[model samples]
Target: MFAPQGPTLRELAVQALSSVERGYDLLAPKFDRTPFRTPDAVLAPVSRALRELGPFDSGLDLCCGTGAGMGVLRQVCRERVTGVDISAGMLAAGRARAGVTATAPRVEWVRADARALPFGPVFDLAVSFGAFGHFLPRERPELFAQVHSVLRPGGRFVFPIAAPARPGSLGYWTLLAFDAAMRVRNALWHPSFVMYYRTFRLADVRAELTRTGFDVELQSLPELGRRPDGSPRCRLVVATRAR
Candidate 1:
């Protein structure tokens, strides 16, 4: 669901037909107006979680579309904050919205692919918002490795993950349908825009993080409440690079 200021149906159609980077570039200006942006509610708890673990220095926001995660970094990291994304248009929008005026933690916007981050081990913490679905399951290891490579030892790669919906629930069918449609789109389209809701399983993700040399931990975000079976509805996955 989109707001009145969000992308129109025709605009969304044009984006859906383009490459992922191009599509996001087209959508950048109105992205925060759409449901696609990471909610502030989610951001708040993640910030709180990081605060308990931090007092960190330089931080990086991976796949930082419009810099939602950058806000979280600003609160935690004292030295500098960087937002890395592939889309120039998205980076432009992020710079505009994030108000990087050179007085603050020295926000830097780098146009780079997340799979091949250019920075060295310069960050004490790294955060990503709602960007993982753009990466396929097979790509998780490399993605995690890139984050690991950029983070100093004992640094963390943190993000939120909502619990998978129950089989018969509306949320389940919606994601299933969305992922199925994406599969069909990729099958017929060029330069496939890989966004799949069902493929990013927690078990698989934890395994990939482990393989990438992260000591992974999952902490429930109680603000999102719990499922009928009493399991947390949302969780923050904190993957720390070993010292």
Candidate 2:
């Protein structure tokens, strides 16, 4: 659900039809008003978890659209925070919201492809929020590798993973239809916009992270609560670089 200040239905339709980069460009100004932005509820708990992990220095926010996750990084990181994304519009929006001064542990933005991140092994922590759907299953290896390459030895890459939408639920059907529609659109369009809600499966992603040499751990986010079956609704995937 979107607020009154958010993009209108027509604006959303236009964005949906455009390439991912262009769509985000058109939507950047109003993105926070929309439901697409990661909420504070999610970020707060994640930040707390990262604090428990603690003492991280430089941090990177991969695909850091509007830098919502920068709040999480800034809280837990003792040094600087960097946000990387492909969309200049989104980066500009993030810069405006971030309001970083010219000081230590300051915020900086980098425009780069997530698959081909442009950075040295200079970060001790990396995080992504609600951006994985843009990547296909096969692309996870390279993306994970890119994140792995930027982190310092014994560094961490972390993010929260929601439980898969249960079969026959409205959420399940909605995601299914969205992905199906995106597939058809990509099949017919040029410079195809790739965003699917269901492509990032937990098991496959865990395996890929393992292959990329991370020691993976899934810790329950109790604040997000559990499901009817008493399983955690959300889990934080904490992947540390193997020394």
Task: Compose the digit string of candidate 1's lDDT tens values, residues 71-131.
Answer: 8999988889999999999999988997636665778999999999999999999999888
What's the lDDT for residue 204 in model 1?
91
Off by over 4 Å in 2: none
Give lDDT for model 2. Answer: 0.93
How close is each model in CA RMSD to the real structure? 1.0, 1.0
Which candidate has the highest lDDT of all?
Answer: 2
Instruction: Supply the TM-score for candidate 1.
Output: 0.97
Model 1: ten consecutive residues of lowest lDDT: 98-107
Scanning candidate 2 in windows of ten residues, the lowest lDDT window is: 98-107
Off by over 4 Å in 1: none
TM-score for predicted model 2 compared with the true structure: 0.97
